[model samples]
Target chain A: MIKTFLQHELKAFWRARNTGKNVAVKIIMGVFILYLLLCALSAGFFLDKILEHAFPGQNIVIAFCGIILIYFIFDLISRMQLQELPTLKVQPYLQLPVKRNALAGYLAATSIISTFNIIPFILFVPFIIKVIAVGSGAGVAWAFVGSVFGITIFNNYLALYIKRKANLNGWIFLIATGILVLICLGDFLWHIYSIKDISYLFFGHLISLPALVLLPFLLAVGMFYLNFLYLKDNLYLEELNSKKASHKSSTEYPFLNRFGTTGDLAANEIKLILRNKRPNSAIKMSVLFLFYGLIFYNKPAMMHTDYPVVFVGMFMTGIFIINYGQFMFSWQAAHFDGLLVNKIKFNDFLKAKYLLFTLVSTLAFILTIPYVYFGWRVLIIHFVMYLWNLGVNTTIILYFANRNSRRIDLSKGAAFNWEGVGGTQWLISLPLFITPILVYLPFSLLHYRDLGLAVLGAAGLVMILIRSTLINKLEADFYKRKYTIAEGFRNK
Target chain B: MITISNLKKIYNNVLVVNVPQLEIAKGESVGLVGNNGAGKTTLFRMILDLIRPESGEVISNGEAVAGHENWKNYTASYLDEGFLIDYLTPEEYFYFIGGLHQQTQAHVDDFLSTLTDFFNGEILKKGKYIRDLSKGNQSKVGIASCLLQKPELLMLDEPFANIDPSTQIRLKNMLKSINKQHGVTTLISSHDLSHITDVCDRILLMEKGRIIKDIATNSSTLAELEDYFAVGQSVISSLQIDEEENH
Candidate 1:
């Protein structure tokens, strides 16, 4: 049964519509995992030397024991972010003669087959064999290894169980983050408790009494059983699919309704961003990236440089344009046909896009007004970039948007998702990021930096003035390509 | 109001839709009937300018649909669930469509109140996004949005396939009344022969990417379609046997 299930998964990956791109992603991921394995292997091999240098006369084994609990704490947090919950299409099997318990057990067992469960073994087994087995005998070394493996299993299932619960009630995630923060504060800042001491107490005993390894082994078994039970009870289609009825009332920007159809279309676009998961998370990430200026501004090395400041300003103000506008047409892939056939004119549609971009970039510019404390120079650059983004970058993004036809599934998470991305996305970023620098580079190379700023601002103003012509061009281009775009979207 | 000349669409060198000449008069109610892979939807897409033809053009109201924006003002179509914005509530979607056509919210509500029976009390104010609705309900939302446009040319592909029996009957009546009273030109494609013949004055039977028969609907149209499909099934079964013996 397990073999057949694995075969199905392999076939699914191979037979995916984007198999070529998925293969490329898999290869890149493979190289990344290999790099991490190397880092952990080297760290494992040289631990004794590093600890010896840090702790002078103390035994490195005791130092390693003292930090094991802290390692697991951070490990649990990272696992929660990275590990995917094991899911099977249980609906099909439910109607067959298969047992529900067997299916649940398969799901529970597959959760163990992840990189998080293996990394700990590679990092710790070498140290245990090299240091503990030779010094404290082989039986005690076996007990230490067993405890580490058991704890890893415990963390794996615990993270999955909590994430599953978090999907049901979002506060579970907030509460989990809160408890982790408090633990860090208690040990590192408040000094109310020491995780190191607790780790030393427990692992220190495991060396003398090898039989105590059963404690974590039993905990591991208990977590596995708990996951099995959860899966068995919640194996129905509704629970597994998680199509929660959205509680958000449909938003209406009445102020936008006054702008006529363009305003109504822009209002609908806003709802598209807020209501869909992929776009919602994507906008949230862009909003969070507004703080990107803290890295470059006020730095003595970067204080005098104007080009990097321009780059930073462009990014902070126009990140939403580049991120969301890159797939503008594909965002409506589901209803592209309806849109094409509706009463809305193509020119008005383009105007709605421009309206949306201008509104968002203006808001971003106002938020960056505080950067004036960095100097008036930083504020001026941001204003120029805001105009450039609204006029120049938006047009460029929409020009390429006509060529994009890959359908994006809006229900998926934005992080690490590569859906609807194609060669056009990679190529479109070149002109958006580099054109401003190229426009500013020549004047800055000579000592006429202020002239370069004026030139960039003037270019934006010109694009804004001739915006009607640009829309006419875009509308013509869209007319030529709408058929191809609609056909590609329809294939999915 | 639609005229097609030398229209052709090919997928991997296989002609999917190839019509030398076809015309839909201003107030004609036409039913397109074909088996799966007969290119019913593909032909509708070309007329709506959703797909570009390889060889020719679709002219709507004396203007080519390929590059003209005027056809969209008068033509409304729903081909599949892809025609729906699945994230919006049905009412929100209706209002958005209504807003595009310059219909006020009150006018839209009045229009919807008349559709209470067609919606079967499941569509309005249900607080469910279109994606969460059943397939049958989603099609109802799509069809309702089309009627709201008050378009001169209305096109729907298999609108009755996923709808309930009672709603299907109601929709047939609605299509009939709209054509009779408002003189709206409607082109519906469905596999249901009885329903198609009942609703449409003319029927176009398609086979292998070409229209093989164009029959004016009469009392004998349903039996004619049934007999054609019945013979087609037997021919297909015999072909399968021949291939099996060859293998």
Candidate 2:
């Protein structure tokens, strides 16, 4: 039965309309995975020597044990973000004569084949062979390998269960991430307890006492059974169909009523982002990028750098404009004909898009105000970049948006679904990032970086003043290509 | 008033829609009848300026619809599910459309009160997004939204296709009352001969991208359409019988 189910999945993949593109993406992903495996293998092969150099006079095995916990912590976080739950496609199979246990087992077993589960083995197995097997007996080394595999499987099922729960209730996800962050803070900042010591105590002793391998093996089996029971109990179609009932509350943005039709349109766009899966993720990702400054601003080496701060400022302030605007018309591809035939003018439609971009970018700029901790100079650069984003990047995004004709499926998750992406998205990034750099390069080279910042700010201000002229041009460009866009959207 | 002169559309070297000349007068209810792939939808899209014709244009109220925006102010169309913003609740969608036509919330509420029978008590206040509604309910929402605009010219494609038998009758009566009361220029395309003939005074029968018959609906209009379709059906059945006999 499982083999038949797998065969049907294979056929579905082969028979999809975009098989050519799907295969190309798979090949690209395959190459990327292989490269990551190669890097991990090399790092594993040199782990002993590197540990010796980093922590001289300490036991290399103890140092290796110390870092293992950190690796798993990071692995858990990455898996939470990137893993996809395999649920939607199982609906049809539920009606068949196949047993629910068999289907649930297939789902749980298939998840273990992910790259996240294999990457650790590629990185750690070599160390077990070269360091542990050579130093300890072969029996202890094999037991150690068994324990690592057991723990990897345990983490896989645990993460999958948490992710599934998170899908049902968002608070689960928040609580899980919050717990992980607090644990890290306690270990790193407060000096309350050491994860390294705990990790060394657990894995370091497993070599001497091979019987301790039962601990992780028992954990893996326990989690597997829990997941199997959960899936078996919840395999009914009603359970899946009822998920949308929890999302029924409607919101009214009363303040948006003031802009009349334009405000109404912008409010509708906000609903599109919040109510759909793909756009919701895009908004969440833009919010996540708000903290991106912490990576560069806190680094002592990057404190005095002008170019890095400028780049970060532009990204932090204008991220939503770039992310959301690239698919402006395509976001409404489902209803492009309705929009074209309605009483709304093309100019007002474009103006609504401008208002949405400005509103979000301004909100993002205000959110980034905490960067003043670095200096007032950082705040000034961010403000200038914010202006540049509002005046310049918004237009660039909308201009390139008119060229994108591919329709995006709003219901699909944003992780790897490349439905609406095309050459135009790639081409738009050049002007979005590089134009400001070009304007600032000459002044920075001549030791007048402040002058360059002021010039960029002034240019952005000038564009804002003449935005109506630019909007008129964009509206004309949109009209010229509206039919082609409609035709392309209708093809799907 | 609407006029189509020398309108043409070709897809991959095949002519999809070609109307040399056509005209609709003010306050006239027009029903376009055609089989699958007969270009009813393509023509409707062109009239709405959603698709640009290869040559000539659609003129509405003496203004060319192509490369112009004035015609849209008085025009409303619902050709398919694409016309709906499925993420919104029905009331929100209606209010949004009403706001586009400068109608306030109270105005929309007043308009919706008239559609209670047409809605069949399943659409409004259901706490469901348009995407979650059944096909018949979705059609009701779409048709109701088009009417809320109080458009001078209204277009609907197969409004009775997904609706229930009861709602279909109710819709036919509602459309009749709207036409008589508001004198709104209306265009609809359908495969149901009796329904179209009963609601629309003028009927256009199209075959292979051309209007084969144009007749004013009277006592004999439905029978004439039934005979035409009966002949086409017999030809198809005969072809299938020949294939089966050969096998």
lDDT of each: 0.83, 0.82
- Residue pairs with clashing backbones, model 2: none
Candidate 1 stretches greater than 4 Å from native: A52-59, A169-171, A185-192, A237-251, A273-331, A345-488, B164-166, B238-247
| TM-scores for candidates 1 onward, in order | 0.81, 0.86
What docking grade does candidate 2 earn?
A: acceptable
Task: Estimate how well candidate 1 is docked, as a DockQ score.
Answer: 0.49
Clash pairs, model 1 backbone: none
